[model samples]
Target: MLWAGTAKADYRDSIAVLRIGLVETHVAATDPIKLEAIEHAFSGALGIPVEIIKLGSYAALIDAHASGRVGYAIHSARSFAATEAACGCVRAFRSPVAADGSTGFRSVLVARDSVTLPVAELKVGYSSEASISGWQIPHQAMRAGSLDLPKLVRAGSVGSVIELYQAGEIDGFFGWLPDVPGDAGSDPERLFGGWNRAAIETADPVRIIWSSQRIPYGPHAANRSLPDDLVEALGAFLDQMAVSAPGLLDIFEPVYGGGYVTPDPEEYHNIRGLVEALSDRKSAARIP
Candidate 1:
């Protein structure tokens, strides 16, 4: 859709208003206020009036992207991989660095400091059966160790699982930690950037009993249906935010830490494999 500098077509004729979809996967802010803040940053950077679409289900968000119901989405690596496979969506910009100044995070099994229980006997809480860090990675970890999935007490959200663990309702929960690598920092906000820290830390002193391999953060993906010029412009607008207003990066929930960077779609190949495996497991579970 490129044209001569002065011959550029007006985007308004094709779409009424630009739409950006945000998924409520791990974060705690369920209100519209968080969405509005994100809209402000993007509007300021792109000079485009944007509408916010808050999608609660990751699957629904991917379907929306594939169908072109929305042009952009701040997606999880697992969800992004699925959408890319389904509709050829491409990554525009990687997520800002996490609190530890790292581009990736890890999934962990957390429990209260005082609790002392065998891994197989503990009552475990998972955010959802569909969550990657909260469920998938942790499940795979258990299987690798010949450990069972533990008692199934699904909280439906990371915030909920942490709350349950703190209340002593469950012995432990599977969640995330910042990919600090050689650095050891335990700030929950830095560990899980997008969600509210206060909402996540229900226990005074929680400890990680298990940690998974590094999981890369999600990216801003554009649907294949978008014009090349518009896609390039959108990517440029995000790159500008990293330099001009890095602090504004906080407006994008679930994304905290370093500035944004351009990402190759291949970066998510490993995650896509995990998502595909999880899908197969789910299908097998349904057969019985």
Candidate 2:
């Protein structure tokens, strides 16, 4: 029986195999290839045979982590908080730096050039109700005014939502804007880059009307049920990768930068609070 994450030096000697859970993200389509590289890098570096488990959703991944079916997982800070709150999974390390050499990302509300902000009501698109960047954070920002979530179209992914908006299928869409330079601070234009920037510069432009608070980089979380020795070893291996094998970290979808670091629980304090607040709001709204 392979009791995952219990090996010492030569993992082959133990019946245990290292099972790594990858959080499915916008880049999920390429997970198999990325995870293959990850398996090779980690197995070679740590002498442990690794098995990669790709989960389809954050909720599914979190449930698996809580049940011990997953030994470790990659997740956004919001997901990390939720997992910790639910199953005591703790952050093993911070993800590599993103584009713009920052460790944080932001969410934005974008619309066709014809649309403007503070419009009383218009069709809006969201990735999913559970998405931190696509829904939760953006929803919190919208709640500051007359924006009502129920009126928002629940598009499946950031790309899909943006597509609907571009096609004039929706008025605006909430989506993640990666690599927002921390130095840019609250500058709206600087924060809008990548495809959004392209749209802004092109003939048919898009407007970034709202930007969410900076979200800390995602984290690598370890299940609490794993042995202490294995946990320490995993951390050590990650630290080694941060220094010695950074390219392998491309699997994490870091937009701008790369390199792991010890995660500070304090880094996620604000995000956790925001998530809790949103949860409370949802529960309250559900009371009929």
Candidate 3:
């Protein structure tokens, strides 16, 4: 039942984080309100207290869930892989449907100034293990543009990419789209540029040079010890959150596309395969 979040405690704080055995915390990914909604919906569906956990970021979510410290999770495709690989009590349950009504979201190559550029020429930056967006999608998009990647770098997160761009360390980068706005303005259009409801699109300020085909988002998962009925009910509750189609669209609009769909683990095999291929390529390249 222990969820993940950072430990910054004051004696006066009611919800003390120190109580949880937190390894670390990262930047908050999804908003707190949205998280509350998700937790409530899951609780209503499962008819259980359903201790909701907050993860700092994708990596933290992956690590905690993978390590079994946190039993359940809804995380990015890449994070899911890391968790699945973590042992102890790690596995995947479901991937959210894309806002476009697909199994997953698309990867867009973006320039820092928000300008469009040749997908291939831009030195795409990504997490060391961005299975879908960083590697497969960008690589595929680059090939489509008939441009070979000039240089590929491994960055820790989007913030790192922004820093690099500001420092002129890299021209442009490609990575996974987020589920919320870019955190730029009050309107929430600045972050993912309000592309949360669908795949990343080309804007006047930023050009979407290349976009990979849609892929499944993340899974609604729990520890291996979780009873089968609980998992099924949790998924059902998430599915039930849509009392009205319009009500459901609220979540969909952010990530882009139609609305939430059922989880599909098999669909991720393509992404998994791509990661394996990338490892092989990297190994071959390293061989003198």
Cα lDDT of model 3 by residue, 171-243, tens digit: 6666544432222112222334343322222322344454555456665566776666655654565565455
What's the TM-score of each model vs. the native? Answer: 0.61, 0.64, 0.50
Can you rank all candidates by lDDT, best first? 1, 2, 3
Name the TM-score of candidate 3. Answer: 0.50
lDDT of 1: 0.71
What stretches of model 2 exceed 4 Å from their correct place?
1-15, 23-37, 107-131, 141-182, 202-212, 227-229, 251-257, 273-288
Distance from true location, Cα of 89 in model 2, Å: 3.4
Candidate 1 TM-score, C-alpha based: 0.61
lDDT of 1 by residue, 90-198 (tens): 5545565655477677787766677777677778888887787788787776766744566769898877877786687998777777665476645545545545566
lDDT of 2 by residue, 1-288 (tens): 576866644435552677777755645335567767877876776577778787788878878777778778887677788777775656545465654666676777766667654544767888788687777776665565534443578888766775676677787767666543436544435423455554434334556666666667877777766666666677787767645776765544454345666666677775776667867888999999
Clashing pairs in 1: 97-258, 194-254
Clashes of each: 2, 3, 26
Error (Å) of candidate 1 at residue 190 is 9.6
